[model samples]
Target: MIVQLSDIELTARTLVMASQILVILLGFTIVYIAFQGYRRNRSRPMLFIAVGFTLIIGVQAISAGVYVVFDVSELAAGAVSQAAQLSGLICILYALRMEG
Candidate 1:
């Protein structure tokens, strides 16, 4: 069966897709900047922070892909992304304590 979208619906979906791509790109940029700072400072805690940002990037990209492929609810997708982000941050905190 063929699916039909109104012009407004098509435009909205395109905009949502564009925003998701921008979010993914910006998240990776953050991770790259953090990694570069870690390299320059030789700081393990900064490395952990970079790792956390990497996880955030993964969440952004994977959650968007999941939403597109599986049509998950916004609440569910946000929950999944938040859980990943929290996990990464907790690990980073632990690494920071160890570095201290």
Candidate 2:
């Protein structure tokens, strides 16, 4: 069966994809900066920040791709994405709490 999307729907999807790409790029840039800070200062918190950003941004995109490729339920994909985001938040929080 072939499915056709309306013009509005197609446009919305395109906008969403473009935004997601932008978010991913920004996330990578943040992680890169954090890693650079870590390398320059030898700060564990900066390393954690890098890892946290990667998990928060990269994992959700990866999970979304898996959902599309594997035909997973939306709920399952959302749960995975939420989990990754939560874990990332925790990492970021821990980084904030650490000294030096």
Candidate 3:
């Protein structure tokens, strides 16, 4: 048997790239806000957001890179997906906690 990058895989790759980009952007925003808060002598909750977002983005990028460079094994794909999801969930929880 042989495996190749199908249309679905391509679409998934694109989605992952877009998601990572968004996460990075959000991380940047968090860092910027944190800096501003520091200058203003306010609570720097944005730092936590930045850390969470960074973790999510980093994990996602790693997963996407592995998917692109390695063989498309089911186990590898599943692990990447799970890592991305868990990181994303953690980021969301952190964001919500900060906002609340």
Compared with the true structure, what per-residue lDDT tens digits does model 2 show for residues 1-100?
A: 9999999999999999999999999999999999999999999999999999999999988998999899899999999899999999999999999998
What digit string (tens of lDDT, one per residue) describes model 3 on residues 1-100?
Answer: 8879999999998998798788767766765675576467654455455555555666656666677798777677768767765776676576567743
Between which residue pairs do clashes occur in model 3? none
If ranked by TM-score, best first, what sequence of candidates would result? 2, 1, 3
The C-alpha TM-scores of every prediction are 0.70, 0.90, 0.47
The residue ranges of model 2 lying beyond 4 angstroms of the native Cα positions read none
Per-residue lDDT tens digits for candidate 1, residues 1-100, read: 9999999999998999799788888878878887898899887777887788778778768986898799799899989989988988886786678753
Query: Candidate 1 — what's its lDDT?
Result: 0.82
CA RMSD, predictions in order: 3.6, 1.3, 5.3
Worst-scoring 10-residue span by lDDT in model 2: 60-69
lDDT of 3: 0.67
On lDDT, the leading prediction is 2
Q: What is the lDDT of residue 50 in candidate 1?
A: 78
Arrange candidates by lDDT, highest first: which order?
A: 2, 1, 3
